[model samples]
Target: MKAMSPELASWLRGRTDDSVTVKRLHGDVSGRLFWRVFTGNGTHVLMDSGKIPVWPWIDIHELLRANGFRVPAIREIDTRRGWVLQEDLGSRRLLDVDDGQYMKLLDEASDIIVAMQRRLDGRTCADSIAGRRSFTPAFFMAELENTLETLFFRLLGVPMNELLELQREMRTLCESIDPSSVFVHRDFHSSNLMVVDGRLVMVDWQDARFGPPAYDIVSLVRDSYRDPGHVWEDRARKFTLAKGNMNMFQIARTACQRSLKATGTFSFHYRKTGDTRYLGYIPRTLRYLADYARICPQLDGLVRKTYRTLDKYHGEIDLRDFRSANIPEVRSR
Candidate 1:
């Protein structure tokens, strides 16, 4: 199917009186399509939602930019068809660049997130989808369980016994977490970051939440798209230490927890759609689990067991009609 529709064109023209040209580009990750548009004077990017629409991200991006975080501006929004025309933050994502360039850019991005944390002193965006929800242990557990069951059990065909035990342990671990609510960007990885004109611009921020500060940081350092080495981790550590003023123990704990959650997400994406690219991340994901286990010392058994289960089931997950799969659904409270 054509990415653009006549109605979409009319909508775009309505937003801008000047003559506009649209060029379709290819990117399929979130079940949506991206397009690069060129105008006489400038350029813009448009995203057309194919199956899984993320229209809310445009609003989130605008809110983050307004709060002094660097992000692409929303030029136009059409939620009816989930299409958005946004300022073209040049497409040189960190993963697209060499290690030296990527690390430097990530260090700068870390500065932005730190600034964002300072601004987030209980001051949430008034016009965001994630208003003032507290990231309590219960809420976090719900998210993990729901994503795991839907993405792993149903889509990956995980055995019932294994799914049950993992869910139980995950819930227990989540509940034991001490509460600290800071503004969180749910998916802050390398893919969602753009290097535009020597500046770092974050994108795909619809799933913003009020959570712990380490949430976004670990997501960046332990990113699956680009397996960064010790150099990036060291830079991230230094950045966090300077701004957050936390010790090694606390930072290590947070990183480990975040990495575990991220591994589940990567596995979910792969199993739900047969996307093997995410599988390449398993090794790194396991490494993160090991790191966390050594630090926590309590989750050692659970971590080792879960890792073995995932490894044993390493194969293509045939996820046909996932939405129709009648798995045990857990709604966020």
Candidate 2:
């Protein structure tokens, strides 16, 4: 079967009659398919969000655009089917840049966070989807529950009793972060940020919501995909501007939660699809947990136990999926 559907091809040609063709681009966890549509004159980025609601993407795009952010301009859209043809911002993601350039450009990205934190205040975002909900402690723990299931319990076979202590300690970590919410991109990692014409263009923002001020910085500096090299304390401090003056402790606290969350997501997706690429992130994120444990002594036991369990089951995990074959409805209330 052809990768391009007849209807989609017709839709593209219908819009750009003089177009050459469309080329597929690597997609991410989000169910959105991105395409670079080539035409006689230039190219346009086509965002196919599949059967999901496209309004959030459109709504958030306009919100960011009005806030003086560099999001793609929507040229055409089919809101019912979740299709958007927008400006092509080129393909030089910050993820693909060298360390020196990545370091320099990341400062600009960090400044973007500061600007949003300052400009996109609660009142400005009060009517938008981002304003509707904030990342509460319950939400943070719910994400960690997924990690406990996939990584600790299901995959590595850690005992339930052992995880209880970890869970209790992590609860403190969750409750420790600043409760005040700010408009955040939710996933402000390198891959979602495009470096075009000596500037940064943010994308993959459909999941934007009001989260802890440290959430976006944690996602960027301690990015699961790419390491910021050395430590992230200094970089994280630059963006930790909140009402409570949330400091390094909050940054490390947020990192522990976010890294574990990412690790769980990778494990869930890997087991469901048998994809080996997810395996690579598992160890890296675990390492981040170790690093953060030093900053927050509460995570020390959880970190050490995680390492021990992972090491004990390293061979089994490498050999096969083992006990993680079944996706259980594990919940911790």
Which candidate number maximizes lDDT? 2
Question: RMSD in angstroms, all models?
Answer: 6.8, 5.1
Clashes of each: 1, 0
lDDT of 2 by residue, 112-195 (tens): 888888888889988788888689899999998888787777766668787786688667778877787888899999989998
Q: What residue pairs are clashing in model 1? A: 182-211
What C-alpha lDDT does candidate 2 achieve relative to the native structure?
Answer: 0.79
Candidate 2 residue-wise lDDT at 261: 87
**Native-to-model Cα distance after best TM-score fit, residue 280 in candidate 1, in Å:** 2.7
- Runs in model 2 with CA error above 4 Å? 241-244, 314-333
Q: 97, model 2: CA deviation in Å? A: 0.6
lDDT of 1 by residue, 1-333 (tens): 365778777877777644788777766556677778877768888887745556566666666767778777778777777888878877688778887788778888777678777776565654466555557777667767765665456545578888788787777677656466667786778888888777777777767877777667777887766767666457556866766555444455556556656656766776566656665554565566665676577677667767666555522443222223322222221
Worst 10-residue lDDT window, candidate 2: 319-328
Error of 2 at 332 (Å): 30
TM-score of each: 0.80, 0.90
